[model samples]
Target: MTAPSKQTVCIVDDDAQVRRFLAEVLASVGLVAEQHASGEDFMRRWQPGKAACVLLDIRMPRISGPEVHDWLRDREPGLPVIFLTGHADVTTAVRAMRLGAFDFIEKPFNVQQLIERVNQAVRLATDKSAAGSGNDGWQRALTRREREVLRGIIDGKRSKLIAAELGISERTVESHRASIMAKAGASNAAQLAAMAAGQPPLD
Candidate 1:
């Protein structure tokens, strides 16, 4: 069993079956799971500083996912939220992204994809907790391309491979890498990687 201190992948959906299925999926990958039936219920039960990330349903009774996200931004900004929507639209997706949701995925989502995203979110939460609040500002400083490069670096790709994957030159990849390091206030690649993973730099 996961200890109480272990991070949980929390699911907030109105449908009981969906919640059960999600919980089971998370368990299949050895991740701890928590579930709530509605947004209001989740908000009422949620405690600040818990080691958890939320998989929020877009449409729910009492409060919507975006509404809950707004509330969380003010209360537990460190908690990462990923939106799950059965009826996805451009406007809703845009709004969710604008509000800083970790990611907005459509329902009937691929199981593997969902698991991967959950794993990434959990890693992010763990990092944020370890790195302290200043890390959030560094993350926000990255541009879209720089963010992609940072992820590539975290995946252990070299500049050459990242360039090929991103369809850019090796020189361009290096430039992006340097920019990411600077924006993250990292003096070396190791420190930048630690920052990207939300870990405090090693002394």
Candidate 2:
């Protein structure tokens, strides 16, 4: 019998035992884990195209997970990361979430849940990278007035300030913002900003 081809996963941690255990867990489910000793080690030999998802340890000997996350964000912003932490605090989890981590999982967690999130992250990455389709659908989805409102949103103007700038009511500005969020498939103002950053600012 032949073995199934492994889906590559990059595991970065300073502990040999932890790496081996993670590698073993991945291999159990027909996935392959490439172990790196530190954030520096992973960066030096980072291959962007191969790995499906990077499972990173938040606390390492030298470079930390958040640092590596920043590095990847600057270099390959599309890369997906799932942070593995021994210390799970509200602040840490919130910070990691803001930093675009797929999930912040504490140590001694259910192996199955971790794998499930990793699989979903891989799929999301695939979908987001595959086809962005047309910006026209997105543009047409916004009303003329909404586009005008969006310009201020992209320019970092507050809703009240935007209303004052455009000689409109704050309620009207909020309505346009809601419309913009729905049209762009973005959940929050920051997500709208990210989507706008991927395109030209509304003219």
Residue 168 lDDT in candidate 2: 96
> lDDT per residue, candidate 2, 1-203, as tens digits?
21222157899989899899889888887777899999999999897667767888888877888889878766655556778887555356446554455566788768888878777656544544342556535555455787888888888889899999889988667656754554454556787787887576444
Identify the candidate with maximal TM-score.
1
lDDT computed for candidate 1: 0.72
lDDT (Cα) of model 2 = 0.71
**Could you tally the backbone clashes for each prediction?**
0, 0
Per-candidate TM equals 0.65, 0.64
lDDT of each structure?
A: 0.72, 0.71
State the number of backbone clashes in model 1.
0
